[model samples]
Target: MGRHRRGARREVTVADLIDALRRYPADMEVRLATQPRMPQEHSIGAIAEADGLVWIGEGRQEGYASDGVAERLGWR
Candidate 1:
């Protein structure tokens, strides 16, 4: 048997996030942080272009349902 090693975590850009959202749609999850920070919300929206918002953390997995699309960036 062999041990598995975690792959290098790449810096996910806005383009990447948008692409993933389009591809997965229902499985995409994200977290956003503004200047003063805001409340926590779970939802994903359509990303047309990259804004000034910084991508603090992001990743994808299974088991998410496509309830509805969000209008702004948020958690999931």
Candidate 2:
């Protein structure tokens, strides 16, 4: 009889999220979640958290335009 083989489970890490997000267009929205007080910017890049994961996405624009603009405007 042949022994059964099992597939390895992949672990998602902060780096993994960043790589995946980079594949998308800048205009696209990437969602993740991370520590509230985490450093928002880095010397080589920036980090964003949404839905419990950290990802690298587009940087802030000159006019502060954002895909989730509606949500931000609601605070006022």
Best by lDDT: 2
Tens-place lDDT digits, model 2, residues 1-64: 1112454456667666568668889887443322233312212237678888775554433233
Give the per-residue lDDT digits (tens) of candidate 1, residues 1-76.
0112465456666577567567665755454332223333333344443466653432322233332322233223
Query: Ten-residue segment with the worst summed lDDT in candidate 1?
Result: 67-76
TM-score of model 2 vs. true structure: 0.30
Clashes of each: 0, 7
Alpha-carbon error at 74 in model 1, in Å?
21
What does the lDDT read for residue 49 in candidate 2? 84
Task: Name every residue pair that clashes in candidate 2.
Answer: 32-49, 32-50, 32-51, 33-50, 33-51, 33-52, 33-53
- lDDT of candidate 1 at residue 73, scale 0 to 100: 30
